[model samples]
Target: MMMVQPKLTVVGAGPGDPDLITLKAINVLKEADVVLYDALVNSELLRYVNPNAEQIFVGKRRGCYRYQQEQINELIVERGYSKGHVVRLKGGDPFIFGRGAEEMEYATAKGMDVAVVPGISSSLAVPAYQNIPLTKRGSSESFWVITGTTKQHKLSEDIRLAAKSNATVVILMGMGKLSQIVELFQKEEKNELPVAIIQNGTTKKEKIGIGTVDTIENIVEEQQLSNPAIIILGEVVNHRNEILQVQRNINSKLTKSA
Candidate 1:
């Protein structure tokens, strides 16, 4: 009889980009006996898995949950024992509202050896990709990443405080609560604060709407943005245009010389 060595490795696939997955994560996927992936994970990364490995979609998207959290926990244990190594591939940093720590705790409590590989979080990458710095030297010395909704599906209380701070604020999965967000910021008398809503960020399908708190709601309606998007609020939002303008000026100088 063969001795079974069961293990579970939680790997972050990064934010929506196939090329963003870490080399260490790819190696882990290659050795996976079973892989459970999420909705935000780019499918192209699956190609790194061994041909004989079992691949499963355990993604939970808005309004669609193919497998609940409890079921996924059980699947990891069951597959780990049967398949040797079970890899849980999640989108973005698993610890960033991805419920990755819970999965690790469950697997560890079940007596399985657990490991984690961190990925770049969308909260930071999405805004940076658009030239919107989450933290700048003077304009924004800090930033806060807040979830759009709580476990009760209510707008997070953290938003109210974030709106009142000088730090740049990034709200994840908060598109549905745009009106509520506006109300909170307006209450802070930050009606003219710069805000940027980005959807499908860092991907070819990305769309952006930029406006002040007083006008962002209307911009969202006009752009038709929805879930899987992030909202950034702060003066740092203007840095994007400033950077672009600088680039244009350099281009003009080169054009004249040419």
Candidate 2:
């Protein structure tokens, strides 16, 4: 009998909302024999996994990683070859700073059939949920998404250029570097530029802290915002206030009618 090679599927679980998960991701989870999920992923998503499937927690949290990257890669390859079907469920889009590419590379190197299912990236969804559009007809023509931390745990040089450009800037996993990021803009005389930091966006625990480059770092500190947050910097941040005002007016009219 010819041997059958096991398959590996990396599915993006979307931003924290369970309903945001795509049907394709759910389908793959239901067919999985083993599921390795991240910490940021909503626990509700696990319900989609087959009842007989083995679930593993491999998420990385502040100052603690359940499984190191090297170990995770090896485990995926091992399970993919031995287990009938393996699903690596990640938070947000697997390619959007989710480290899904590394896993895919490792799996293919081991001769395993790998597949990817893209999810809604918090970079775009989080800002939209807060009523902040990444681009506007006259305000911004482009947007740049940047990682807050580099291999050395320092701010990326791209942020400097981003601050100097007219493009909207979105920073992921950058709450810790908030002070430095704000200072970068301050150096470029963008002190009054609007900035908003949203923590746990798209979930029930969501909180948004809005300020300007001059005051945003302090506002985020006072609000106790932390990781798993998205930082948006540009004129687009002001749109949220306009949206809220419009919503308040509508609510007032409805209440009076009632």
Candidate 3:
């Protein structure tokens, strides 16, 4: 049998949209001998891989887990040795919240050559697709990207501080804490602050709920929005509507003139 060197490449599959992936990611996928992908990753991306490559799903959802973290780490090393090239395909930028660093360190310590390819994170792309800017000069001078839950699986305390600031707040994996999150902002007298929840963002299944700190929880319930979603808060949320209104006004004027 021909011998191929052991290697591991961590590639970000981008958000939900298959097209959002980087060209470099596609190139890497074409060379993969084995692919271990996540639940959040769009399966459409798999078509780019080598025809004979072995594909494995290591995805873990809210209450469903295909493999635990420790098991996944071991799988990477095992496959790298037996298959030659193992691709750890993750959703969004692997380093952002995906634990790409930990995987790299583990595999490297096990003697596997490693490489990383960054993907477009949903935090920025999701809201931008809705025409919501995280920062808009005088309106929003800055933005904060925070996890919805901590390593302990509890609501993050940082949300309290972010609530009191003027900066835009983007929370990932936060749908379950929707009620508590809004309550914090409401306590800060931001009851009317614009809020938006985007589920399955950047994909055909995308669903969005737009309201304010006081009303968004109900909107979420009525809309039945769930995890794998992005929550955006700040005046920035209003920008999406404002852009839509501008387009509406332009179309109306053109209709009248014609």
Candidate 4:
């Protein structure tokens, strides 16, 4: 019998919400012979996996990594070919700061058949959940998504440009540098620009802290919002309150009808 070449499937688990996972991702999980998942991926989604599938936790959190990126790459390549059907599940869209490309590059270079299933990125979904549109007609014509930390563990230089531009700015993995980010906006004379930070967005523990560049850092600090959070800045942040008010009124009406 001819040997069947093993294959690797990289699936994005979406944000924190298990329901946010795509049907395709679930289908792929059900077929997986082995699954390696990240820390940010919701464990709830794993229930869809084949009961006999091997599940490995290779999560990386702030200040801690169970397995470095290089190790992760090697494991994926090794197990993918050995395990027949391998699923590397990542949180959010794999390409969007999820390091999905790096893993795919390694797997493909090793002659393994690889595929990607995109997930809903928190960059857009988190803001929407908080009622902060990344772009609104006549408000922001463009939007920029930036990483809060660089390979050097320092704030990225692009943030300076983002601070100066008229585009709505969404910063991921930036809670630790909240003060530095706020300082950047202040330097650009955008001190009063609206800003909102959401922690564990789309999850039950979701918390949103809102203020302006001059005060957001303090707001986040007081709220104890930490990493695994996203910072949204621009006029769009102002719309959250309006949307909340509308929601409240609708809820009240429903209650009265009931």
Candidate 5:
């Protein structure tokens, strides 16, 4: 008897935009017998899955998690062998912010065949859609992307170093702890540095909150910006206002011509 090779395919659902999903990802979704998706994965993307596919919600929103990591890992292993094709769908690039590597390790341990399909990471696309360049030619050259949750919401070392560096600092899943994070940078000498928090980036529900390191916490409080968001800190953020102005000028010209 020829043994069926069990396989697990990890697919990124991209940012909030369903159109952003890759062709390869779509094909995998169609072939999948089961899809285990993240909380943040766009619902529209799921519509592309085969109608007969079994859908499972194994994602946690904010810190209010429903499924534990161990449980998710076990599900992938068990489902891969039991089901024809098990697709693990996550928001953004699965390997980047998502815990794709951890899941991959778990599946491999169980001798399941595994494959990864990369998608657009919100860390890069979210800022771009808002016209906030992560890196500018002379103004800024590099940017750092770090998770706000480190070993259960502890401060990441990268966050501390980013407070002093010239590079742009972008934090994912950091909205809930905005006060603590802002305090870290504000305590530094560059307390007056500009900051911008974009919530629901790249989506129609997107909102931008702007302020300085010294006052952003209060601004966020006033704005009530929530997560599934990205926080940007640096001189590069200042360019967003300029970009908006330029866009307005172009629009004005088009209006005048019309």
Candidate 6:
């Protein structure tokens, strides 16, 4: 009897770009015997999986029948021990608000080998795609990333100050609490500040809703924007329109030249 090789690789799918996936992650998927992926992951990346590999949807979507964390943990453990190679794919960096750490801890406790591959976080990438630089000398100096749906269900105290400070704020998984989150910033008289809510950032499905902190709640409501979105709040949000206009002008010039 031969001892089976127990290997578990948790890979980040990046921020909605199939091409952003790491070379190591692609190789892991290509060699994996089993791949468990999340809802945010682009399915196109799965094309690299071994033809005989088993692909499972373990995504946890809000208001949907999300696979329980415990169940997912067990699935990873079971599959990892049973298969020669198992890959747990997630959107964004595995350790950044991705629960990848939790999954890794559980599997490691069971004596399984685990490795993590970093991916681009939408919190940072989304704003970049929108041309809203998180930090500019005269604009912003720092940025904060917070999850809107935390156990406390309140913006982190650090983020509360960010609302008042010059730091740009990016909230992930926050669509459902959009109104409340905006109100949190408004309570301190930061309501007049610019903000942008981008859904499906970095993808063709991207949609941007812009308004002041005071008016964003209504704008988002009127737009019916949903989750899996990145909310940017601060002066950086004020630049979105101008940046987009600049991009359009550049495109028009290229078109005319062609």
Q: Write model 3 residue lDDT over 183-241, tens digit each, in one string.
A: 89989999999999999999999999999988998899999998879999999888888
lDDT of 5 by residue, 174-232 (tens): 87777778888877877878888989888889988888888887887798888778999
Query: Relative to the unseen true structure, what is the Cα RMSD of model 4?
Result: 2.0
Candidate 5 stretches with Cα past 4 Å from truth are: 1-3, 253-258
Model 6 global lDDT (CA atoms, 0 to 1):
0.85
Please give the ranking of all candidate structures by lDDT, highest first, separated by commas.
3, 1, 2, 4, 5, 6
What TM-score fits each model?
Answer: 0.97, 0.96, 0.97, 0.94, 0.93, 0.91
- Runs in model 3 lying further than 4 Å from the true structure: none
| Count of clashes in candidate 6 | 0
- What TM-score does structure 2 among the candidates reach? 0.96
TM-score computed on alpha carbons, candidate 3: 0.97
Which portions of model 6 miss their true places by more than 4 Å?
A: 152-155, 247-258
Model 4 pairs in collision: none
Q: Where is model 2 poorest over a 10-residue stretch in terms of lDDT?
A: 1-10
Question: Across residues 17-118, which tens digit of lDDT does each residue of candidate 1 receive?
Answer: 788889999999999999999989888999999788999999877788999899999999999888889999999999999999999999999999999999
Taken over the whole model, the C-alpha lDDT of each candidate is 0.93, 0.92, 0.93, 0.91, 0.87, 0.85
Flag the better candidate by lDDT, 4 or 5. 4
Q: Better model by lDDT, 1 or 5?
A: 1
**Candidate 4 per-residue C-alpha lDDT over 79-185 given as tens digits, one digit per residue, 9 for 90 to 100:** 87677788999999999999988888888999988999999999999989878999999889999999999989999898999999999999998877878998889
lDDT of 6 by residue, 67-186 (tens): 888999999888877776789999999888999999989989988899988898888888888888888778888888888777676655666666677788888877777767777787
lDDT of 1: 0.93
> Where is model 1 more than 4 Å wrong at Cα?
none
Ten residues in sequence with the least summed lDDT for candidate 3:
60-69
The local lDDT score (0 to 100) that residue 122 gets in candidate 6 is 89
